[model samples]
Target: MRSKTLGKIVLSLISVVSLGLGAAGPAAADSAPTAGAPVAGKTEAAGKGGPEGIIGGETADSSRGMAALHRNGNFLCSGSIVDNRWVLTARHCLYPEGERIPDSQLTVRVKSLNRTSGGGVVAVSDSRVRTEHDIAMLKLDRSANAEPVRLATANPKVGATTYVFGWGRTCATCAPSTVLKRATMRVESIDADDVYGGRAIRTSGLNGRTCHGDSGGPLFKLVDGQRYQVGVVSGGNAGCPDDSGFRFASTPTSLTWIQNVMADF
Candidate 1:
């Protein structure tokens, strides 16, 4: 059963204390990364690697918040392969703001994700979730079959590096639209004490963070030969300049929750 209330909060969330929080990390991290993949993160939204890059440096000090979005005019979000057929994402992405959408109205694509370019496509079969927990699982018609990202079994750690990917607005404190976007962000920390503590990464020199189209994106880390998905793009403070990056956070990683959900499969 869902343990918390999952709803959309379009409010701008900054890292200041007394804000909100979301359990950015999830069940998948307990495993490992995709096989023979880069040890660094390639967290992006739409297709395979959405709009993110390796965490070479940091970005501005701001952020944005959003739900599900598109990539190259295709329906997709930052998702990760969990188990043989389930792809995990934020509850809001599957059910934006926790609002449910008819299953028929939802689909997924994991092909070539390019904003400047474009590439492959995969169709999701079904979806399941724990709304209160801010988590959802997308059932793919076929398994990734290739090197797929896994989740962490480790406990949520403070100062741990968290990655984020999405197609939201490119600026913090700016207007957001439902367009395909992508970027690699960092997790300054996972502040569970805050209202929606999904503290994610910020750009190093940019004045913005995850925007509107970024919701339901992937958050991962490198392990072994693959990328291990740990969180989904949630929300954050938007509206910033190119010099002051923005904020973006994900859900926390929980072990029991992941095992329980995947056991059914």
Candidate 2:
């Protein structure tokens, strides 16, 4: 059985702290340095390569609804456009467990593959966190011109192929990528727990895995040529290229909560 908590996972592998500023080195000059509050109850292995970006991934051709979250001008986490004025991302990306982040400190860039340029930036007007999960929804100050991603209604089958996108580091000790990256992973478990002990989907890298700076990124599955979001990046083994595994907050498992939360927006 998969461990039901992050503490067990951390004992065997490193936990992803913050993909934002200071987790990776400096970012490109055009963008502010990336950083986010550290995940609660997790420890990092100093100088050890950890989850921050896509390892063995390639440049994304397009990312229609992707959102690059920033805090005080610093890159923080990844998110997906679920509505014209709403985004879905990891709660940890906003603050430590049980803590809150002010709306004034958060901003989002959408409809662009590059986080540094070529997208509309909007301030976060409000946010709501799921008390039982790692996910959170942010309300934008204005409607985004980009199309929103569809949320999967069912759990992804085991061994199903999935794609993940992020602007996190390409490798441990590397700076966060300016361009978005995509990787292939296989569903390993539908019953896993995220860093915050929320329901999660576990995946193993087929061609690549998530690293730092990738927290809150989307895990997508294709159906009948259409893409649907199934999960959100949560945490993974220390090394991105390792076989330990990666965990994502399962979107389908929390669909009701998501709909309820979005209803208020």
Candidate 3:
């Protein structure tokens, strides 16, 4: 059966304060190319925001290699630093209606968990994406000066706990969270294909769900007490404040695409 194709609805990149990037960012990430549709289910409307609280989760102090992709100072989507000069994010994040936004129109903030304050900011020089999946690789004009995140060498176990980090909304109708929010979810399945025919890792979230504005956010798994990125936030059926939705992303399946692109960057 064909899964319902829920468009990639990345939250509007609205900022609380001016981060000096100007106000020319894309209005919203609504029409951009996306990873896939929401996990199997009829669409539901709820408090659409990312996860919160430490029910075994906590507000991350620093994601080390995390980066917030901004357009004209407005928050767009989340990305993971893969190399000193490259960031891995959802391909949909770079285009709106299939037209690629120029690198001059974007900026990447790194190091700080807080999106508005305390981070190294740099202009993007270039971006590379493949149509096979919803992943993209960005080249920074200069090094981010922060350590890049490690890619998982193997898929995570179905029952293992994983963490998601993002600056997505705190509520469906609320503004984006200023500080990076972190939540812990259990891996429910691996290698599940989304509506777009892309393989994804599905996770179960109770109090913590990946919501709007979290597109391309990193899903990390602890390997020997070290954080390794195993997935990227793609989409979910409903928003937050309502705790009954599953989150899915391109991870183990994306590793090859990520590596091939990074090698050329």
Candidate 4:
């Protein structure tokens, strides 16, 4: 199934904003990519954040190290290797809000972003938007390099460093940059009072956050030698620097509940 109309639907997707960072400039992130850094090249737009509210906002700095979720050369979002065969993301990523998209109409390009690559990239669909889940599983066209990320059954530390990558917008004024957009987003617990997050959804991290075109990206938590993909790059309040410029993400653990959907394949 394919989406027949893709107009304003992109703007209406569900969004979650979390976190607040203080300092920790980009020059300071030489060691490990912080889990929550600013959006690459445009921290000012989303404004400054609180102490624990961090990010890895250096997409251009490291491309090889980060995984490319799209098939061709570029898309707004980037994906992580949750499994050799499946990539987790938001359902709105492929379908968006109010759009009529059929899963068969969607493609989960593994490494490439555009359409020129060899074609090993998977074309996934048949997504299931569950009652308690905001996650979607993309079926790869074929098995990938096979270095899958390890999922944390336990709770992820609030201040833990995490990396988010995607083909999302760099800045509001700047044209959406090509290549993968990598950012470090710190994990922080948003107030339970936040609208997007309720009992089923535990949210976290923000400040330098995501934007248009970044739909369906992956938020990864590195543990041991493996990366645990937790959050999907969803949408936000139109452009960055939204009033205060901060935002949050639906808990990555929500992705875990969708396991049975990908279990067989």
Candidate 5:
């Protein structure tokens, strides 16, 4: 089993390169490309390394309220804006199983395709973790002003199409992507468990799969041209880009908790 600590260690190492690049300052926001739209059958070769990014994926054309999480200026994980003041992500991104992470050490960049720049960075004022589920919610210090994604009230059925987004590595040893990337996948098992053994949604890569740095990223299901977040990237097996073994905590399993947390904010 991929332990929760394994996920943290992988992400920590990935952050080294990110910290160096971030020190140089944010790059100019690249013009919105027409390619951000979801492609039906796009794929890329996986790079050799441990795990990271969407192996065999394409650059995301739209941010769709995605947020790049950073810890002490180093890229950490990915998240989604669920409200003007709330960002939802994996609990492991915040800290270990039982520990608490200080709100001051975390920040989220929202409304941008580029993680290093081109988005508003907001400090976290408060956070809540659903320990049993491996999911967490961060309360932004102020409104993000970015659009929020709707949380699904139920899990997608097996074989349902889904999409995942992140700024993780493209290859095993590659640095994390500066631009957001996404992959097409199919729900493989709604009965799976996350790294922490929380109820999770397992997916098989159709054209791409979630890897390192993708922790806490959103797994979205499209309905009526609308995007509903059905899962949060938790962890996966080591063989990324292999078209199997991606797992995300099922959002519907903890919808009531999410609502209560949001209501308190």
Candidate 6:
């Protein structure tokens, strides 16, 4: 169950406290550099060695329209397909405030755990951002032709086991991995006072953590063996790789907005 009603003042305070937290570390390059390759920001550990959840948690499969995005060979962020041509992610991945990057600069990969290989690739033709909750959608120039992941309709119960997927840095100071990763987390709370209408889902890592470059990744709940994406990676504390902090995300609390955006597109 969710917490009691929170006034706008409390919600504003929570939003302020959550700000400045990053989704993950900066992205890593897609290929190994020969020499003098520009090293991106540290912490792109998208399953560098082991995932950021329960230490021995198994890696997740890529059958659910999982995608990793890149720009000029540098890993950008992670996302999932919600429609034939629409990809869901965090707004910060493609924009700075109100500015949206041109679609020509972005590429999306699907159907592969290896970010560098094995997935079908497509160019982004457009993007839409909902800054209030840090959620966004990208329109692919062509269909990925893969089945999109199902979105969760109801609120995930507190204490329920959930999973997160991404291509973020393996640890706080380590380089970002090109392969996709998954970790298990437990629902901690619902930010009933979040400025975005209490859409924030706070989750505790079981064994692994979400580090750099994991922004826009998916938080999923399994229902009777099927995957339902319930949240989008948003912000968390800086104590990554140590497994001591909680990560927050945008969830179906804004389902109406998500549906509205998809319909508009």
Question: In terms of lDDT, which candidate is strongest?
Answer: 2
Which parts of model 6 are misplaced by more than 4 Å? 1-57, 96-99, 192-198, 239-241
Candidate lDDT values, in order: 0.37, 0.69, 0.60, 0.40, 0.68, 0.57
lDDT of 3 by residue, 91-118 (tens): 6666643467788878878876666656
Residue-wise C-alpha lDDT for candidate 4, range 136-200, written one tens digit per residue: 56665666554455555544566766655554444543323344445556655432211122211
The C-alpha RMSD in Å for every predicted model, in order, reads: 10.9, 6.1, 7.2, 10.2, 7.2, 9.0
- Could you tell me which 10 consecutive residues in candidate 5 have the lowest summed lDDT? 33-42
Model 1: how large is the Cα RMSD against the reference?
A: 10.9
Per-residue lDDT of candidate 1, residues 60-148 (tens digit): 12112212223223333445555545666655554433345555544444332332222223445566765344466766567544334
lDDT of 4 at 6: 22
Candidate 1: where are CA atoms >4 Å away? 1-76, 115-120, 172-186, 193-208, 223-226, 238-252
Q: Which is the better candidate, 2 or 6, if ranked by lDDT?
A: 2
Q: Once superposed on the true structure, which residue ranges of model 4 sit more than 4 Å away at CA? A: 1-56, 60-76, 112-119, 173-175, 190-208, 242-252
Those runs of model 5 whose alpha carbons end farther than 4 Å from true positions after fitting are 1-18, 23-53, 96-99, 239-241
Residue 143 local lDDT, model 4: 69
Q: What root-mean-square deviation over C-alphas does model 4 reach?
A: 10.2
Candidate 4 yields a Cα-based lDDT of 0.40
Model 6: what TM-score?
0.75
lDDT comparison, 2 vs 3, better candidate: 2
Query: Ranking by lDDT, best first?
Result: 2, 5, 3, 6, 4, 1
Candidate order (TM-score): 2, 5, 3, 6, 4, 1
Model 6 weakest 10-residue run by lDDT? 31-40
Off by over 4 Å in 3: 1-57, 96-98
